[model samples]
Target: MQDQTFPWLTTLIVVPLVGAAVLWALPSALRRFARPVAVAFSLVVLALAAVATSTFDVSTAGTHQLREQTEWIPAIGASYALGVDGVGLALVLLSVVLVPLVLLAAWREHPDAPATGRAAVLGGDRIRHYMALVLVLEACMVAIFAARDVFLFYVVFEAMLIPVYFMVGAFGGLRRRYAAVKFLLFSLAGGLVMLAGVIALYLNGPGGPQGFLVENLIGTQMSTTTERLIFLAFFLAFAIKAPMWPVHTWLPDTAEQAPAGTSVLLVGVLDKVGTFGMLTLCLPLFPEASRWAAPVIIVLALISIIYGALLAIGQTDLMRLIAYTSVSHFGFIVLGIFAFTSVSIQGASFYMVNHGLSTGALFLLAGFLVARRGSQRIADFGGLQKVVPVLAGTFLVAGLSALSLPGLSTFVSEFLVLVGTFGANRPAAVVAALGVVLAALYVLLTYQRVFTGPVRDGLATTPDLSLREKVVVAPLLGLMLALGFYPAPALDLLREPAEQAMELVGVQDVEPAYTSTSTIDDGSDQ
Candidate 1:
């Protein structure tokens, strides 16, 4: 670990937290300025994140950098510890970049007028509360990614649920409460199982003032059964958060019912926590169990690939379709992680960031369309290309990126994953590759239904993307194009961490079966 005297990580977490509190405590007279105030705070946080990223040393991407630690719970051996490697830094950057955009996209999301009926019964300024919850969520996202202590990570992990719960339940659509409850139930169940694993693993470690630090626990001696059991406990929690096929039911409901900006963060940044944990903590903490469980996990991932894509093809609700697509994308991430090849893990890490940009744009664009027509159903839209060309065009680019078009960012990551996985497990790679075809079906078919053909009766007069909306989307699309063309910079950051993961798992890249050589003969010799 490379420790920094300045508390960069803590400041990143605290700024948004203090912003949230300030938003909540604003005077009634100044309540009208809530959205601007919130946006300003988010922008400041983004600038700070940029500075932090600039300070990160890409040369030492394998080990944690800018680490900060202090003793917290001496009896239980927990400490306030934080740091970021290439992977963590990538995610932290993703979270900060998206927050200001999400805030801008949702600027007019909540009305300033007093609430009515149920909302009135729970009186307060809706915009203020919603923006504040988003900030709080931002703080938690940063903390979770940077946390280096097991206890600190787990605490922030569970604490994330509170803000998301209110964001959905209070600020979402008609079925908000039901969706929020379901999300909470699934997450809590996973967290509880993880808590058990955390306790068991700690008890097995060298108990001391800082026993729960990840570095200290990495190579602890344990029996085979105990380690495998603990690994399962942690894996199960991640899978649910990863929201793999069987346990993935909650995501579509939540995505469909929650506000679009909320959905962006929920699916975009928060879900990455699961796959991130598997890569950073699981493999290092329990290497044997990871190898033992690889085959089963790979099978589940393949299932998610096919199952999610197929369901996405059959979806009517636009939000649900996008949600299912994420399920498929996440399957690829999980597969790359378990493939245990340097290239595949690098792809998985890159996939996390790319997925955020592409899918976040999709969700936000879909939200904009839904807001215009007052519907999320594909059947409710048509001929929108003529009516709203800019919106339709942007949506097409984002959708194409989702399908992993050759010139887009997702293609690079998905390609690396398949190539790497093929070397380790040919059949799994073959099965997962079918998802690409299925992806085209879902993306193009949905585009045709929603943005092509004759203008639907009510949508002919639909407006195009507003200036603010364009501002929200332009950077996301720009980044995708930039990364797609030149991925070397991002790949450089990802390579060492991927290699470290492979090292921990005691695996190496698969070597070629044969080498070919050719010699040129000169005409004079002939």
Candidate 2:
């Protein structure tokens, strides 16, 4: 790990936090400036992230860089540790990039309006609260990905629930309260379990001023039973955060009820924490346990892939449909991580970034559609292409990307995942491949139902995307296209970390069965 004199990670975490506080503390007279102020803050954080990315040493990205450490809780040996490997950097970049876009998209969200009864009793400036929550969430998201201490990671991981809870409950749709409470309950349960694991891990480590630092914890000895138990503790938290099967029910409801921009962050950057934890913390800290658990995790991943797609196919709510697709996409990510090949791990890391772009675009565009129509139901509108060609076209592209259409960024990552998984476990890969087919069904069928029939009664007069909306979507699509054709930049950042993960997990890529022969010289030799 390369320690830095300058604390880049702290600045990245603090700027948004300050921004959120500024929005919250803004006087009523200046409340009108909340949106621009929030946007400005997010942009600043984005600039800092760009500089950090430029300074990152890609060659040694397998090791942490720009690390900063100082003692925090001496009693328990915890410290304020922060760092990023290639995988962590990729996720950090994803978090910062998405926040600005989400802010811009949500500019007019939560407008002030007269309320009755309970809403009146709870009333304040809704837009201000919403923007503040987003910035706060952004800060937490960055901190979680950059955290190098297990205790710090856990704190930020659970702290994130605060902003998200309000974003959904206070500013979301009809079922906002229900969705937010459910999300909180599920996440808190997972966190409590992981908390037990974190305490157990520190006790198992060499006690010091910084005992909870991930670097310090790596390779500490433990019995099979102890390690496996700890691994399951961490795994359960990540799986629920991952929203993997059995624990995934919160996602669709939350997505359906939350504001569109909030959903983008929730599924796009936030959910990645689970998979990120699995790769960076789980496998490295407990290799034997990861290997021991691989078979069951792989099976669950396959089920997530197939089951999520099948459910997505039957969804009537646009937001809920997008949420289910994420469940299916995350399955591919998990499969890649546990497949234990360098290629597969790299693919999983790449998928995390690409999934954010594709799904973020889908959610934002769906939000635009809902804003125009004032409804989230797919059956509420039809024949929109002619009336809103630009919106229709963009939605199609985003949907196609979700389905892993060739020449799209998602296809490259998903292709790598399947190919790599095939080398390790062919049957699992084969079953997961069925998700690709099901993805096409859900995406195209949704498109057909929402955009392709004769002009629906009210949609013919619908306006095309406004300039602000277009600006919101253009960057995400551009990046998707750029990465789709040329993934080397992302792959370069991901490769070393992936290889390092394989090393830490004590595994190697499966060898190819066929080899080319270069010496066929019967007649030529004669």
Candidate 3:
């Protein structure tokens, strides 16, 4: 339990939301200050998140901490409840860490720069609106991560699509509208399906305040048919959000068209809700159904790994290529979760953070390239390292992390995932391992094509990373290194949730077999 003296979790959600409102309501005369104000608010939330993390009792991390609740509507068995286990805290931290950076990176997303050839100028209110939406999106992200009530989670889950939809549609590139509509349609379809499951869970549950609380729903009684039906409802939604293979079409489009900051939040943090849902809701809520669905899910996960990697390798559009890489990375996350081992689950959880940083940097750096070159096509520029060694170097490091380079943040999580998968399903693990090769091929190939050849006809004047841009990307790159060399802090935070999740699914690691072979000389036993 958290100290009653302060509602830290609620504050984390409210601060950004309040800032959004203030920014939105500011008079036009004073509106020029909106961006800085929004950034300041995000920094405050980051500070609060840091404080909350520092005070967390890792010894009790397996269970929810910093719990805060208030009755929203007792009649429907819904309440405004929030809490964080190690997994949720880790994700919340990811959100906070990324939001301020995103704001800084996107400081000019609204007003199109001449070189980028992005959307035309907007009214004076555009920056205000954009910054407000970003803050709102951040608030929803925090709420979803912390919500302990299934009903509340669903509300925030569906609500999240709103700000992102606008961000894509209003502030993106040429095809922003199409991409935004596609993203919204897919997400809404999934949300509606998941809502059905939430309703069913409520109807079949023990009536009263405890009904929607996750703590009360686990191990609850339901007919096998009911359980499976509800599981499918939830799984379909999460799978779509996870944007697992078949349902992943919306992502590349959105990534290509949306502003880079929007893409960062969408792929880096928002998409994580899908895998997070599966871990926090699906398995625990329907243990039997999860195990029953494991084989099929694992197969799909494998397909996502291979299929996404292949597509990424083939892509000409840089943003779309990065999008496909996330599809592949997400496959690993889902594979780790459904593998039902402590190591795998923890790896998946840790991967969420690592993926956000690694992939986020990739997108940001790629966006920088696009902004400078005014083209996303791979063939448009070459020999970039000679002109912008710092930017190219940062991109290379980020790319290596994506490929799970040793001593990088992603390597720790990826290794754990593969090892855990091997323990559970050798064949699946083997197939998924192929993704590493594909990852290397795509990343290296992209690097070679874009940075190795002769400089394009007129790109010599392209500048290296500016002070602000470097500042924006430095922490993300630095953390990847910091975490890579020393993941003990993160692993310690993740262990408890992994154990708890394993307990829910009744899974334990399979011990390795050691055969004792004795050489019997003349039938003598030694």
Model 2 clash pairs? Answer: none
Clashing pairs in 3: none
Once fitted onto the true fold, the runs of candidate 3 whose alpha carbons sit more than 4 angstroms away are 1-3, 110-112, 115-124, 513-526
Query: Considering summed lDDT, which 10 consecutive residues are worst modelled in model 3?
Result: 511-520
Give the candidate order by descending lDDT: 2, 1, 3
Model number with the top TM-score: 3
Local accuracy of candidate 2 as per-residue lDDT tens digits, 1-526:
5589889999998999899899989998998888899999999999999988888999998989989998899899989999999999999999899998988898755444322111211124777778888889988988999999999999999999999998888877767899999999999999999999999999999888889999889998999999999999999999999979979999999998888889999999999999999999999999999999999999999999999999999998899999999999999999999999898899999999999999999999998888777778899879998899999999999999999998899999999999889888889999999999999999999999999989878777899998989999999999899999999999999999999999999997677524322556789757
Q: Give TM-scores for every candidate, taking all chains together and pairing residue i with residue i.
A: 0.95, 0.95, 0.96
Q: lDDT per residue, candidate 3, 370-410, as tens digits? A: 88888889989799988899999999999999999999999
Worst 10 residues of 2 by lDDT: 114-123
The lDDT values for all models are 0.91, 0.91, 0.90
Winner by lDDT between candidate 3 and candidate 2 = 2
For each of the candidates, the C-alpha root-mean-square deviation to the true structure, in angstroms, is 4.1, 3.4, 2.5
What TM-score number comes out for model 3?
Answer: 0.96
Clashes of 2: 0
**Decoy 2 TM-score against native:** 0.95
